[model samples]
Target: MDVPGPERRLAAVLAADMVGFSRLMEADETGTLARLKTHRIELIDPAIAKNRGRIIKTTGDGMLVEFHSIVDAVLCATEVQHRMMRRNSDVSPARWIQFRIGINLGDVIVEGDDIFGDGVNVAARLETLAEPGGICVSSAVRDQLGERLDGVEFEDIGEQIVKNIARPIRVFRVRLQQDARSPPDKMADTVAQIGRKPSIAVLPLVNMSGDQEQEFFADGLTEDVITELSRFHDLLVISRNSSFVYKGKAVKVQEVARELGVDYLLEGSVRKVGDRIRVTVQLIDAESDRHIWAERYDRKLEDVFAIQDEITCAIVATMAGRVEAATHDRAKRKPTDNMAAYECVLAAKVLHHRSAREDNAQALRLLDRALALDPNYAHAHAWKGCVLGQTWVYNWCEDRDATFQQVAAELETALALDDNDSDVHRILAAVNLNREDHDKAAYHQERALALNPNYDLIVVQQGELLTWLGLPEEGIDWIKKAMRLNPYHPERFWNHLGRACYCAEKYAEAAEAFSRITRPDHTHHAFLAATFAQMGSAVAAAAHAAEVVKREPGFTVATYLATQHYKREIDRRRHEAGLLKAGLPA
Candidate 1:
């Protein structure tokens, strides 16, 4: 039996229950009830109401409250708990009334005036885990609050096995003392390292063209807008890796802002009809959940770059109150004037990201078409190198050497055409790293980071280079940062993290990272086997080892080692020993 047409929405669910309701009632029913009523009237109810919380229902001992904002929910809970502690100071410990609170941000099912779902259930379970006069929050609630709630501190209490919840929930305890601050987490540290500039993330634009094929166009437009916005060195624009994760998903701006650690967000849609395209963009102050500026552009498809320029300038002006003369000039530098070529590049990018043999082939064809249309298109040239490199890496091409040469030539041309292009530098860095040209890779990686500090591809490559440079711990951080930046990042990112962890001798962590990939190819299996072997899990090692040989019969430690670019002989030998212990061919 299912309820039809039931309303549902995302909310921060707060569940609170008295610590000793039964015992309190036994002590003095009338006195306890009166004191509870007074507390709610004077402190609890006012705090919830002030923070825009809707009290969905109230039991004799507890209440279920909903808040549109996670921040508000936590704020209300903390306020009530802090006030209760102060109010109970004069009372005997046995007579003091206390409520344990838990908060979770999740999607809830709404029926009449009540909400039902895992969101509410989890909050209730978390409430039971809270201390008598303290607050506990699910990771979702804590992440959504991320360094935003000043004077508040959250200590990660690790994962909790809550009843009725299949998966272990990561819970954080909100310290009753509001002014205490623990050391910032990695994500917070990364945001801080990026400087205190007005940060903004541009979400992928929705494709409203009534054609699924136009999705590439929408994504491309979004990327261009992000690139244009990134050119403003003064504005800390989040990379497409982080922002595009929200593509085709229903998300609240405040949640996105908190997760990305950005104060502002740019989001919109693209609708194309024939030769004309309509683009709608809005800049929002994520903290206030208010629109700062919005505009709709109806223009010929050829004028897409102009639209990007307008959007960039508008955002810069809105955020900084004025656009720098240099930034405004940079915004107008179009990638290419040829519309068909631009569209081809966009389509090719979508195909390239798919990372399949057929898709890579199709991407190459599109890139060729793009290059033919506009020979000087730097992005197209760089992307062609990327596709060719992928083909060579996967042995998709007939001649690996020839493909490698073409990749190098294309990247060189791209570099000559647009020395400032971040993709060009990013690709060059990757290419150099693959060939063991450490110094060249380092140069390009630095340049790429400078050009597009937040680009996920570049960020992850930094980790890759660091791993090869025998700095696996540092590499792991960059890879993880890239993963956070792009929650939907490519599966190969897991491979990168696993490799870094393995190099760092963190076998269990490496195994976990590698296991996150849904479809493990032969290479992934080989790494898993090696990781298991390192951890002395002989049975697990042998199983993954069998998988490796089953997928590639000629798999041998020698061949694999030859392909790997480990700067240190010790690291290289460690991988070799692991593979040997895993029963791979000598």
Candidate 2:
């Protein structure tokens, strides 16, 4: 009973294959097949069923499954791996069977019982990319999983040139770590050891509304959640840049855990239609890939902040339990009573996050509108400070001093209104750093860090300030710590690290640090050029110099230094001199 017509729809595809299957078969074909059957029956099948996935087909050493939810597919994969590990614990190491799995979410052409198209091909390619006993996921699947799973680490393997695929496929490897079991300590009479607190990464919420324009709303909501949750001192929050790297990918929980060293994950999606918006959120155990909690909210566009608050509260509540009651209650305080003003602020923040000149201008305008609507809005003022600070730093404005003045005024007002706000402190630190008020910058940076020690951006900023203060060695140490906290940090962080290394006269390290960043922006290229020049690689320096010039035709040591918005005249002069020495023209 074969249907002749074509059936096309979006679906999550899970593909897995045994590692070294051919080699195992050559050694003992019958035994290998028998063991695989036993493993599938005893471990894989039940795990898949538990996660609500349907086994579609089996290809001797491989299996394909279909899931309605990407979360289920990831959970199934994690459980299967866990069970396999347990099963192999007692088996001989040489005889153990390991499987590599890949999950993808995309449109697939389904004809009766069979599936076809690039979706399946992507999944197969991912499976091939996965290391033995590891999981590889496409960007699509990772987006659907969202931030629900904590401590799952993802290593960006970058774009893969898959066979038959027109474009290179982005792949991520999920890092899962095994938990250690410890017996009660009886002989410890010395200082008490405080175990490290559990950590979580909130991946960027996917804009599932099909319209590309709704991306800002989704990203805004995600940033708000991150900000709200960061108020809790006990929980670690990965920066937007690091988590957003997993944007548009299918990732494994274990891999996420290993890469980010997080214990939990929170992922969600937003579907917006005019005045109405639907948000779906889930929290997952990164180790097990099991959904510990999940919720979906449908609300009017005006109530988006309320919905975000609720999601943030629930996640915090789950993590620290009743201990976070005060934190949860504090989170309920609205930034503004005027819904319109709040929406304006959201719009402004979304635009600001884009980091484009036009977007920053739009964001500043929206922030102005928000302030006009609600004069006493502390969060709006804080965000206004951020917008102005970013504008100056990113060379979005011609009058850099005026932008700094605006940032200083807005930040002071924000702090006066709500000194407890970590974001205000962070922005104030940036303003001070721009003014070369190193002491003040350090004070605000430390305050922000104290409010949320796990805030990776603040940590990075602190390192930057340290470097500007002539403490290049200390700056390198802090930046390295920040990198350790968020291994997948954006190119900017790596660029900062390279600059810090350059300041420390670690030219080789600087080159290596800059080399890690694949997406070289103007700043990255400038830093790479400087690093290569310092390393005596004139050819490499010339190559990156061309890239810098291409991005900013008028780019020179002076202009590049001016764009950085460094407050200290001494620091700016030193950096400019270094770049000039590295072959950058004045």
Candidate 3:
């Protein structure tokens, strides 16, 4: 009786069964089958083929297929539904042929022209979970859809305790509706509805150094200024993750407004050479793409940070004063026009953005230099502390605990000097998040957002914190807002978005988010692999798996765990769980 073996391979399994096939067949077997065959031949098969799907087998009332890409699966599903709706327009409800579809990707056993195992089983179970004439999918499928398909809504159904399964399966119901129409011309109404609080996005400063290496300096400076502005508690600054999306892109202000859902935009450029640096900046009304204010500063290299602070202060004062003057009566505050301390901080920003051990050391040195020039330079101290905290978290420092303590002390000093300094408070919030003080993190983050509603980095950080705190739906909203503000930001923003969706068990969305990153490293590649595995695309999973192994040899759960050092503990855990579920070692 020892005569059994198995065949195995990876594949994506898509199952579509008639919603009321039995009842329809009983009512009219020949008529129902005839219509089903006609629909499959005329619409479903064509749409599937167009989306690059392959039909594997078809039962009398159902069809099982596979797709090379999850995107294709979704597109096919959407097209199938749309075509079916069109075809059924003239038919009565009882006579119309509707379907419930499910899709999953994973490894499976192929036995004599048939598929078996969890991959097939999950797909079948998911199909059962689908609402009649609707689509249901595992988290894996959801991650791949990202923002490509608009107006499609999803509802989380939590973990499904499926029959014959040891672990509970998380599922989501997808709602497909007609595309959303554009909003009516409601400019006046929108302006009136705008609360007294103003919103803004800080676009990544252009690097005019003619050398790509200097990009980090420009980006770092922009991030620092955004962080500083976020402390305002009344301003709605866009988040860094969102604003950074516009890095290295020439975008129209009106388009930026429409995307970021903001009123203002801040753009700038940095030029540096030996012993000297020149910076230019401007604030624009995003709705009209009109420049409201512009400035330029030229100084010796040693005085860069001082100039940066002066410019930051001026920009904040000008923007804040304009809003306050328009809505209320308040005197605007101004900072001393000290060039020396500002220069030190600017130089430190250049070092910090490099994000390497040597560069972080240089940043520290420059911060110390700035402090020597002006002990009351609150922004410089706060930025220094923030950089130190990042260095510790990134494992660039050996004595991380000591470094964190030093950062805390510096942040306290910064706050003592200027309680209203939004940047200082934002750094403190990050510190609290790292310390697992989620409530404090949220409070401080909210305060920062209030001060400068336009600060993008703060928004991203807030979203990250929310995600960690098990408030993924809210986190997703914030992250989407950030992306709207800076559509062209770095790939990392998409990574954060993917992590959020994955945590929320929106697996298809997660996959779509991750796919947007053109080139991913070990962790990101692992995320992609796991997502593919969960979706039942073994081939894609294997490809990403090889990359993950190449990048992180001997990778394990511990290694995966070590990478979950987000500002918030909950976010960290959620991210880890996402990758783990996707089939990463952890």
Candidate 4:
């Protein structure tokens, strides 16, 4: 027994893990598992084998491999990362399958298809430090691979104190340069082409309150920061929808900037503990992966607005050289002095976006509490109108007529309280559009646009308004711009685009746009039927017509046309004819 010693050898270890594995699994367990299997069979396993590496073990979302050569380990990791980026090009950013890989060269103990020691442990720790779709290596690995790989560079992140490691380990991030044969990173190039003004994206602030229910508070804070920054017209701010895709994900600042087409990124966390709140924010120059500015504020909960204002001013000053008086004034304006009311509004907003019947009811209750706490809160009133309008539009309430009237009253009260709130004007514009008050809708739309030109909701509504005003081509352009402003925009934007295309008599394009929706609802089916009918695809039109009727038996061309706010009689008649031609009851 004394003569029997464990086999020991020097080896290069690689640890790789999927980013946001738990989140992806929770979203779609079956699909995620299938995709993982496909990736392993098609790309990962083959790459490791090709690089002369042997997989020691694999967990549900991660793997550990041993390589004879440090150069082989580095080559395999970098190759997989770049290939993964290409594989994810067609996938939504939120659903992207990205990997974080780490490599180290150290002595290891080998035992029956498994290896153990500081080599494997260090690699695992380094993997945790790697960004999604990135690779990190310890100093030993970096030294071994010096000048071996062409078009590859190492970025020194300095020493990192990793978990369970007694001593600090020096870390280096692997950066790959673009090859001449490869296609350009369009979003990365967009940063330079978007004009001289700097572009920035505000990622959703992390909720550090130790309670999942408080996520809305952090989200509200992040949105308020984005809104404040957007008021500085000199800066191009990415919309909330596009920026929020990175929420709760481990992302590289460079990857995020490339994806969002922004020159800068603002990321932070919110910790609301007891009556005190702590906010930590950092402004990063994405291209250089450098922190342009950073700050931490510890204040009472009541001083949250002041903290936001300070953060906004600091960022503006750091990026643009200075903040204007108007921008400062705008950032300093608080929606409500009552903290409880602001929290209520924040919670309500999260519920409203869920679009569930129970969530809609809960949102209304929260808004009621908000109004009760501060009746003069313009945002609360405006949000109350939005919720009621949702109820009317989605048939969530029993008394549709009464809800519609209440919506108008709440919006009117909100506008009177604070005419400067962009959201108030945006909601009012929507209400007026639904009521066929084109002139009022136009005025509010203009006001909303002027107040916050970067706001996606307002910009999209301009397209809707233009479409209804018989300017289909211009409406199409505006809609496309809105989509550009928020790449992860709601599916309804496609519906808007489809409708505008139909109005413009581009039936084929209209059909194509409608096809982009994963699950077409009854209204979507109706539009699709009309689009196909106009294109003389009678069979396709009839099939979609059947789907519409199956979903909503009472649906008819006359009733649908009656609800549409087409300013021109010709447009109305054209849509009516298409529906009838599609075999929809008139």
**Number of clashing pairs per prediction, in order:** 0, 39, 58, 0
The candidate maximizing lDDT is 1
For each candidate, what TM-score against the reference?
Answer: 0.47, 0.42, 0.42, 0.46
Better of 3 and 4 by lDDT: 4
lDDT of 4 by residue, 1-586 (tens): 3797899999999999999999999999998998788578646887899899999999999999999999889888887887677557535698899899999999899889899999899999999999989999999998988898886789999999989999999999998643236546864564333223457898999998997755866887778777767664346789999988889999899999998888778888888889888778887778678776676767777766676665544443343322222222222354534235555666676677666678889889978886776676778899999999989987888899999999999997876555557788899889988988998788778878877666666778889899999999999998987776555466778888999999999998898899998867788899999889888999999999999999999998888887889999999999988999999998
Model 2: residues >4 Å from true position, as ranges?
1-350, 483-490, 515-519, 558-578
Residue 125, candidate 3: C-alpha displacement in angstroms: 77
Ranking by TM-score: 1, 4, 2, 3
* Model 3, position 213: C-alpha lDDT score: 62
Least accurate 10 contiguous residues by lDDT in model 4: 322-331
Candidate 1 residue lDDT tens string, 88-114: 653569899999999999989989999
lDDT value for model 1 = 0.81
lDDT of 3 by residue, 1-586 (tens): 8967797777777899988888999999898887787577546887788888888789988988888787788778876875576556535687988888988877778877678888888888898898767788888777766677766677788999888878888898877663336544554455343223457899999988897866766777788777766655446788899998988788988898789998778888888877778878887776556676677767786755676665565555455544333222111122223324555565566567555678888878877876876676777889989889968777677797899899999987776455445677688888987787877777778667765555556667777777777777898998876665444333567877887787777878988999887767677887777677667777887788778878878888567766454555665665565456545665
Candidate 2 residue-wise lDDT, 1-586, digit = tens: 9777677888889999998888899999998987787566545786788788888899989988988888888878876775576556535688889999998998889877888887888898889888878899998777766688765657778889987788998888887654325423531321122223447888888898997867877887788777767675345678778888898999887898779988778888989878888888787777667776666777787766676665554444344332222222322353534335555665675566556788889888878887776676777899998988887777678897777787888986776455556678888887777675767778778778766555566778878888777787998987877665554454568778887887777878988888887656777778777777766788888888888878888777765675465445675665666576556678
Residue-level error in angstroms, candidate 4, position 463 = 0.2
Candidate with more favorable, higher TM-score: 1 or 3: 1
